[model samples]
Target: MGKRFVLEEYLAHSTSNVMNGITIQQRCNDKGNEAIMTYVDHVIQGFRKDGFLYILLTVAPWCRFFPSVRNVYKNIQEGIAKGNALFDSLIDQREKELDTNRPNGFIDSFLVEHKKNSPSFEKKEQLRIFLKDLLAAGTETSSSTLRWILVYLIKEPKVQQKVHDEIDRVIGREGLARLDADVPYVRAVIQEAYRVQTLGPLGVPRQTTTDTTLFGYHIPKKHTNFKQLMACAQRSKTLAQPRKV
Candidate 1:
């Protein structure tokens, strides 16, 4: 999760800009068109909405049939399609200009692996989905985590003052925080915030492919996360490359 990191770097390194002509991006940011929501704001709202609907789909089976819920579901589906399309355009642009010999960034790295015919990178759809997953999910989670971090910092003025002092000492009061700065106390505060505000206590939801025993405990087949994974896989026409449990 790069937070503001990737977008900041992407603009700097990219010779050929990403499809900056995106209508949705423009419309979202345009003052006359609608309320101001930057691209990150849109991603966060979209993720939050879809997550709520997923919870409904998981627990409230009857709710999916309701007209309002169905309408929201349709909108979410459309939003996802639009997002994937944006990523598809980005991938297409990069595939043409990316230097395979000097692989750069996430897309370039994946494209290089793809050139080698790795099973995980078999389809361009895989690359597209990977981009969407990394960019969208990373933006949402990192933004949410930062929100938690700010909340915690506000509650502890001494800790906040220490972070301020560290920043002043390391980068100067006038200097901006760069990614490379070694601020142990700042890092520790972030880690503590992560511990205290545990998002997803069970971690990402996992589902058993088949009825299985984990440490003599029976886990049923076909759970919610597996269903979601299958839906995404179906869209990508590629199986997930799970590197670790």
Candidate 2:
């Protein structure tokens, strides 16, 4: 995300000579509109290029999940930037603690499990590969999704206000809203926003693992490729129906 912003800054700074036939000093204002747009475009492009590659490979079989992951990352980034100091501080503290207590994280967890199951395998080397996968799989998508959510909330004041109202009603002023708090409406809003504004429109692609039959149709393994169309699914009437799980 930071990389993207930097790219946008470069582009804006390079092309800020004319605005409505008047020359404006591109560098004169610290917060120029052109600068801001450049920064944003840079960030977006950077994410689309580098971030998308790893996500594509790691979750290739489930391409549909990429958009969701990207949105999560975007939202997290926005949340941190918006001065969610508590969340920022907590995440930083957790990283520092983990560095000392368990540097491996999810990769380490996977390695331990695999080692227990397959004693003959080389654990350390396998752990390195797993760590690569973990980092690629874990970071950007979550942050992107978060940032995207923040962007939507900022754009839609009514939705944001409704969410705030729900939060206040459920948690009260005495405490902050926890994940477990009763805020179904807030959750719904988040889901609806994602549905309305898909961060990853082109989802993962899938290849059949084996011959399969579905609805009287036969799909041969290695011959069938499937791409999950999220936009189509989100618009389905069946999904619109409200029901208890």
Candidate 3:
């Protein structure tokens, strides 16, 4: 009967639950905020649709050559386009309200620097892509990593017990885990889960200038998402979907 709470709203309105001392509730227009909240669902659906597309591309690169794949890819591209339009709208609104004297959040901060014509900020498209990545990767990647951690913990009771003991020692029964918290064994358990089951199998693409090798891995001049190999070496890893980067 009531309205659903969305991630955008939570980030905008929350006072303490977020990080880096940013909130957009005060900065954004009420009408724009309402529109953004209503649109968040569609944006999330687009993001999930993109995830499916990524899986398809990764698993069956050959399918892309088929005629039917064109329609399927176009349909998915439409969904992604919707997400892009939503961010573009949000960016437009933020640009209208952005104040350099005191920036609102990440976008505003970036805009301030962008006004100075920073090379990285020269491309607004990059910022849009970053937002897409932030929303998509930030949510599913983290939750998937946590899910894998639980799977491994349940499979390995000793590791679970060590994590539990470490939690008790460091955070205690009542304390919530904070970013600033120090808990090595628990962190190691999470890290080990990452190693055994990599999250970002296809990491962000980066091209090398010259052929280079690091940490027993060889790098060619072409682009590489080394997690393709890490997925092979997964002794521990995190923050990536089972999907290739």
Candidate 4:
């Protein structure tokens, strides 16, 4: 929960910087965290539910014919649609005030680049994909990683105590921003956790460029080995298994 809060604030600030400079965190605080989280949770839910269907669609485009899968896709699209109004308004605001002299965030940056006459750039579609990736993929990955960290800490109290003691000694009353080269253990713990329980068990899927043979098995062009990657990760001896909370 705490991690989720921090992630939301980080995402909101990062996104808001580009959109207009109106910090969404401040806006959420004025309104209420509950409202913001509710919307985010719903959107993340749509992302989680649609994950399998999305993979299926990539591997077998015909799966879209299935009513259940189609419904899930529709719902996911609908969830993204809910945020379209707000995002579009922000984009519009940025469009009206495109100050290349002082670009605020990514939206402004994109606007500046769009003016560069880049033939390959499709401004609107790129912006939509970028926003969707940030809100949906970023939130889920960050929240899950933090949650996994806590799980590890809870299961291993000695490590947790060491971290606490280190923090108390190194940071004292100072905030995390005070952390510097002196914080090796803190970084180590985070790195180890990332190695063991990465939220993305499988790395990003990639399509084959051409026909290939691996271990006597034929792989056609455009075939994705994302599932194979996930399986290998799961079987990795170095990856730690989670203990009961």
Best by TM-score: 4
1-245 per-residue lDDT for model 4 (tens digits): 34534444455434433322222213333343344345556765654666667657766778777887878767656766766755676567778877888876677777787887675867776786676566556666666666678778989899898888888887775655354547788788887777666566556778899999989999999787774444554554744653222
Runs in model 3 lying further than 4 Å from the true structure: 1-65, 117-123, 208-227, 231-245
Per-residue CA lDDT of candidate 3, range 159-212, in tens?
788888888989899989887799877776766677666656666555678888
lDDT agreement with native, every candidate: 0.59, 0.50, 0.61, 0.64
Name the weakest run of 10 consecutive residues (lDDT summed) in model 2.
Answer: 16-25
Give TM-scores for every candidate, taking all chains together and pairing residue i with residue i. 0.66, 0.48, 0.65, 0.70
Model 4 lDDT at residue 240: 62
What clash pairs does model 4 have? Answer: 18-105
Full candidate order by lDDT, most accurate first: 4, 3, 1, 2
What RMSD, rounded to one decimal, does every model reach?
Answer: 11.5, 15.0, 7.2, 5.4
Residue 155: error of model 3 in Å?
Answer: 2.6
Please tell me which predicted candidate would have the highest lDDT against the true structure. Answer: 4
Error of 2 at 6 (Å): 9.6
lDDT of 2 by residue, 157-205 (tens): 8888888898888888787757788999889877766666555566544
Better of 1 and 4 by lDDT: 4
Sliding window of 10 residues with minimal summed lDDT for model 1 = 12-21
Better of 1 and 4 by TM-score: 4
